[model samples]
Target: MGKFAKWLGAGVGFTLGGPIGAILGYTLGSFVDGFSIQDFTQEQEEYKQQTQQRTRVHATSGDFEISLLILASVVIKADGKVDRRELDYVRMHFVKMYGKDRANHAFKLFSGIIKRQISTRQVCMQIRQHMTHSSRLQLIHFLFGIAKADGNVSSSEEQEIHKIASYFYINDYDYTSIKAMFYNESDSAYKILEITKNVTDDEVKKAYRKMAKKYHPDRVQSVGEEHLVGAKEKFQKIQSAYEKIKDERGMS
Candidate 1:
């Protein structure tokens, strides 16, 4: 290993890990990158060492970074087309949360992840499996912040955000409250669902069918699948949510 490879490895690891792991990995990478390489062989050996160490750290962060990217991509693409306002919102949040340098790097990483089609459920499952409840909640909050950054929320964006939050097992109340901060007057998808908390069998079927069609992956295909990973999750969530409502109401 070379110095660059070492730094790259550390970045990959940091992006994959939890908060503490990410901090530690970033610190180590910063320190290592400050040193000058003496020769090609030494550099290669150093790079290899760094790569191994970094990968170990990354085992935790990669999923985190990927998850964020997936959500960001979905949020940006939620309303018909992605706009500069949304991109700026993302950049601002990144810089504010991670600082300028780290934010720049994170933006690049996030953009790369969103630029392609990936599996939203897989990413959410990875987060659910690996992250603590608190961490997951915090992530959900961050996402809510992202959605609200553009002044108001779109129906598509709200549905996607709700779906993401629910995957982390956030309840109807917290999800809606967070969502409420982004929108005024109207109830969120989560809240609307809650209204039917005691819905009849027919209503449950009707709602599910409506939501499935609205959030259907097919609805977003024109924008390309890269943008619909989150939509797919929302689509599935429509089913999951409907099931919960139906089961609670004793509806088949």
Candidate 2:
């Protein structure tokens, strides 16, 4: 198989169908001919095992990159036009994840995707089917990072992100928690901890611990160094949120 074919078939030990498959088919068409659907049945069982092992070694490999690229294009175009800042932001992340050469190639693919209209719901649902909760959460975090690349997350960008999160089955609390990290509005501390003002001191501490573990960078080490960096950013927000709550409540 070719590079794009191999990468596109990396997730779930099989090729993805639906909108993701369609997007890959269209975007990768020029570089490779016929870009047909993958067949897993002909492969030896050992190859399947090796593929699964590779997935374990690199949690963000293969279709995950494709998914990120396509959905990222959607987020970049959410504001009606793509901003250079947003493109740079995504390019940096792609470079970190795949290095300079693959990032350049992927960015070219993204140029195609950015021109097309995508169904956020369809894409999110497809991702939710194959990705774990942590992976989906990281994907949302990346999207928010792109949206705020210009130093502000517009209402349109936020709305598009919210729609993606809803389709991914990410609860409002989790969604807002991630949102607070990028957009520092009032009640940000509360949002980061995924709690309300009505919560007691014990609840605040509990929420802090829960969020701390949830966003710890180590949790995503298997995914890649790029994801670890993003996770650390989220983990720091959780720590800051807890500290703010502790200072205000005098919880020694």
Candidate 3:
């Protein structure tokens, strides 16, 4: 039988908090020998419990994926229209990460749920529920990348991503850190500060100083001294942001 014939013709459905992706991924990967019925049942039970736990938390990886789809769709549609080029970028990213078959499956699943126009906050909360601090930070970083992929970050996109990040449980320090990492310039210096565009110069300096201290590797030893490496990088960014802003405004 050809590959398409093996797809069970189920039309790829989406449900809240389910193990279907794991099941499908496992099944497709095991096509040569077939999945053991017993193993499938056991895996389903495990996946169900894991899914439930994640849903109860803030955001599962699944929720993150769905939220990404939502944000992409929203961003593309923000200018009173959706560009095929932008949509293509999203689809291509999915294909690269999840493979063509699973990517298509996920896109179909997303399309069904997106029509409901679910709350973006709810999606971020779902991610925060199950993700570690580091994971949440990474999600924020990814969101910025997606925002920039199409060239500009509009007010709508910025507002949407800000709302979504709020639910992800990322604190101001971490959120700013992630934003600065992606959006800051290499030479402009303010790229590292992580201050908002609306903030006053004094506030920017204060925030940068505070964040630099908090992320100081020596101060966060409980999470592991090794993590200080990350903190150091973050602090450097903060320093850069502060310097850039001061230079631009000619502040003392």
RMSD of each: 13.1, 4.4, 9.0
**Candidate 2 lDDT, tens digit per residue, 1-252?**
467544445442332455765665556654456543243233324444666645333334565677788889888888898899999998998888778977877787788778877887887877787677777888899999999999999999999889999999999889989998886666889988989989999999899889988887877665556567677777887898899889988998
- Name model 2 segments beyond 4 Å from true: 1-15, 31-60
C-alpha local distance difference test of each model: 0.54, 0.76, 0.54
Alpha-carbon TM-score of each model against the true structure: 0.52, 0.81, 0.51
Best by lDDT: 2
Superior by TM-score: candidate 1 or candidate 2: 2
Best by TM-score: 2
Distance from true location, Cα of 243 in model 2, Å: 1.9
- Angstrom error of the Cα, residue 47, model 1: value is 15
lDDT of 1 by residue, 5-33 (tens): 43334424323333322332333343344
Q: Which ten residues in a row have the lowest lDDT in candidate 1?
A: 15-24
Ten contiguous residues minimizing lDDT sum, candidate 2: 36-45
